[model samples]
Target: MKLATISVGGRPTPAVALGSGRFVDLSREGGLPSTLLGLVRGWDAHRGAVERLVAAGTAEIGPEGVRVLAPIPRPERNIMCVGKNYYDHAHEFHGSGFDSSGGAQAVPEVPVIFTKAPSAVIGPGEPIPAWRDPTGTLDYEVELAVVIGRGGSGISKADAYGHVFGYTILNDATARALQRKHQQWFLGKSIDGFCPMGPAIVTADEIPDVAAMRVSTRVNGELRQDARVADLIFDIPTLIETISALVTLEPGDIIATGTPAGVGLGFDPPKYLKPGDVVTLEITGLGTLENPVGGRPA
Candidate 1:
């Protein structure tokens, strides 16, 4: 089932997608957690109930009736991110002169991990703070982020899939100059409203073969990035195993599994984002996450 968090009567509420751009307001039902994070933390115990509710649900809101927010609007912590996990993107970034992760190896021997501040997250249709970038070199990285359902340390790659709750699209918006100047990703990638996520989180069960799913990004009307999950150099299992070995991943923790080639930095002159540009990211069943470039929030 596709799970989501949406605005209902001005409140962020847990919901189940009924498709055709409609949702069942799960908030009205008692005994369920109030927030998407709470629901996910108790997912195993609440899964059966949520499933039944969806099965019997009648669509309560249409796409035009309410606003869709990020699946987990405020993740409990910074989002864990993998850098240069795609072969072509690795080569493109390495050659682009923005990569400062050290070494001449375009593709790393292990997952290149970093974290984006939780405050950076914004939901669908929200404006990306392109003006706040300071460096004026805004760029977009469309990624597939895994939502952890079960939390544990030292998880084996073999047991990784079992720990995933669902999937969502994440735009790892970056300030290219800041990224290179800082010599690390966190500062450049963590500007407020830099991360645009959601539309919905399609549960793991709904996605039969994740490797077959494709992810892409379009700036305005031009396609910029396109690749399949199978193109991932580290893959999901390896990422989980690699990160979990050091930090204890918790329920609702998000791991943005890097982006494919075609980022602006890959271009000769670099096609950075302007104030009026629109970025649209889509991943098969996860739906589209589109955001516009604009000045600071009012």
Candidate 2:
């Protein structure tokens, strides 16, 4: 089922789409477990509860005019992102001074992970603030984000899918110049309002072929990135197993599967984002996320 979080009467609530622009209210079913983090921690139970609510008509179908929030607002921790997980992406950045060879080598023995602070997250249709730094070179990376269903440590690749509650679209926004200056990715990636996620979270059951989905990004209505998840060098199962071996994967924990080629940084002069640009990211089976760009507040 397609699930979402939306603002009703100025309050955020859980909802499920019922097609034809109708949605079922999940609030009436004991409300949406406080926040998205809570729901993730108790995803199995929550999913069951939501299903029951819909079946019994305890939840009412509402109009489509309501405002929607990120499927999970205020996730429990910073988002975990994989970098250079696609062969082409790795090749593109291999010898660019960021990494040796500009990224044209085989996949790494282990997943290359990074974190984007929770503060960077914004809901669908939200505005992303452009950093005030004159050297800021904002860029976008469209990815398929996996949401952990249950908390676990030492998860095995064979059983990793069991820990996944669902999936959503993620835009791994970055400050390219700052990234190079700091000599690390976190500072450039952790800026507030940089991560745009949501549109909705599709339950794992609804998506049978997570690896085959088509993903793409557009800036100001122009296509910038496009690729299939099947091209991922490490894939989701391996990532979950590898990451869980290092740290406990908790509910609400997001793992961005990495972006495909065609980022601005790949361009000779680079095509960084500027104030007033609109970005739209879409993954087949998942939904579309759109956000506008503006200067950071003083």
lDDT of 2 at 219: 95
Q: Estimate candidate 1's alpha-carbon lDDT, on a 0 to 1 scale.
A: 0.92
Which digits, one per residue and each the tens of the lDDT, describe model 1 over residues 80-165? 99999999999999999889999999999989999999999999999998989888999999999999999999999999999999
Model 1, residue 70: C-alpha shift (Å) = 1.0
Candidate of highest lDDT: 1
lDDT of 1 at 88: 98
lDDT of each: 0.92, 0.83
* Error in Å for residue 187 of model 1: 0.5
Which digits, one per residue and each the tens of the lDDT, describe model 2 over residues 115-214?
A: 9998888898788888644576888899999999877999998899999988999999988777788777898888888889988888899999887899
For model 2, the run of ten residues with the poorest summed lDDT:
98-107
* Residue-pair clashes per candidate: 0, 11
